[model samples]
Target: MAVEAPFWFTSLAGLGAVYLSVVFLRLLPYLVLYLRQPKDLRRCYGSWAVITGPTTGLGRSMAMELARLGFNLVLLDLHPDNLREVSDTIREAHSVQTKTVVFDLSLVGTEKGDEAMRRLREAVEGVDVGMLVNNAAVAKPGALYFHEADVERLVTMIRVNAMALTEVTAAVLPGMVKRGRGAIVNVGSGSTVAVPSFPLYTVYSSSKRYVEQLSSSLYVEYKSKGIDVQLQVPFYVHTNMLSSAVKERMLLPAFVATADDYTRAAVRWIGHGPIAVPVAGQQLQWFLAAVVPEFAHNWYRLRKHLQHRAILWNLN
Candidate 1:
């Protein structure tokens, strides 16, 4: 005997097929990209990469990584001695060219900022800059509410975190567009996503959201022009930049990573854009955030912050 399925049952089966198809279609390319090794991004973008804030932490690490990738560097930072050291190290290790530009990003929009930019342009003039890592940013002293933060501190954070990124991108992107090749890796915060509320880092959180937005929109605008723009949302690295909470949890795999380890993973994923967390632990944290309830995540984050505050500053 032949049996016929009900109309609703057939419809449900069709819908299920469509859903699976959509999911597979959306995920396949990213999976393929992830599985395959990326092309030499430095060769594709240009021969030189200008890294801001390369004196220490993420900046220094990325600069070193790029040097290994055979790209000459124009390293910008506030410290002259560190800049010279990084340059010497890169040259000694890789035989690639290096230029050090001691510039203060916070001084943007002033006479000093203009002078700095002029010097920066001169430093990069003869080189073909291929990659731009906007990794330099200023974090608040510790967890503090908006009202509790000093106005100058808040303003400096905005200048370094937001304004500097915009200005630096503008400085280099035009050449990339004209040359028909380039890649930008703007380091972003997981605070805006993994811990969205981020109770005490109000301004810093907002500034990171701005970076995410800027990277995302610009990616859309320039992807057709052979430019790769990506925002990397890394959770934590055991650098001098770590806040008290992360510093306390430095031994935990999920909480902190050394700059060298983090940078190696991050540099490999450079063109894997528009966002990625190369550290497996941080990547897992991102996954859990997606499936977890908002209120629950908020409570968990708040608890960690409050506990760290008590330990570090004796705040209740």
Candidate 2:
């Protein structure tokens, strides 16, 4: 015969089981989504997709992927030469048509910016813009205290990362609403969603927090209207955006993904949810990071940023 556990021990065991059940239930849907085949994006959304900052990194990769899948593209970036290069490359490789728009996102609220916005509005006027990838962003070159940071650069980061994303979304959402369907994929940082405090990278993470809240709200508001607003949060992508030293340190395949690899996963999750951690490994990393206490997350991030600073400045 087996001995029965004490009353407190039995109660504790029951609670632990209940907690685990809740977590499993929460994660079940995302697991299903990750395993499922991708939606026919052209059928579900529209024919043409607009990608901002489409000249480099994930934005460029996303543009190419969509074009490969037979979606016409409207590419927007600050440089005409780079835009022309990408447009030519896509035209040469894919049968899809391309439109290049040179718009400076940092000039979102200025006089020249007003004219540029008007032009951008005109550029997409007749196109069935089924998707908008708000992929442009800026971050500090190094980890530094808020007060120690360059004020001008921080302001530009806010303008490009947050303000411009908002403006571009505003520009594209109306058409989607009128057409009765569309998708907006806002590139977001895991720093905002995966941790309690980002410490030295405060501004970038905070701006992404805004993107997170906005995307979730839009998803709720537009789901019935046939619009899917998704925030794709990535942990660490091996892109030019990251320093060579940091990339070297993050050489683990599971921890850091290439831009193309991450974008391919990102495309699979569109229209399925308001938020997605596309890379399966990053999903697990996010879960473990979230399980840690807030104090520990904050302390660890601060220490890591400090070490990064030491490496960059040769202080070590």
Worst 10 residues of 1 by lDDT: 307-316
Q: Give a tens-digit lDDT track for model 1, residues 101-131.
A: 9889999998999999889878766567788
Local accuracy of candidate 2 as per-residue lDDT tens digits, 23-96: 67656766887677768999999999999989899999999999999999999899999999999999889989
* Superposed Cα RMSD, model 2: 2.3
lDDT scores of the candidates, listed in order: 0.82, 0.87
| RMSD in Å for all candidates | 4.4, 2.3
Measured by TM-score, the strongest candidate is: 2
Query: For candidate 1, what is the TM-score?
Result: 0.86
In model 2, which residue pairs have backbone atoms overlapping below 3 Å? Answer: none
lDDT of 1 at 31: 61
Most accurate candidate by lDDT: 2
Task: Give the C-alpha lDDT of model 1.
Answer: 0.82
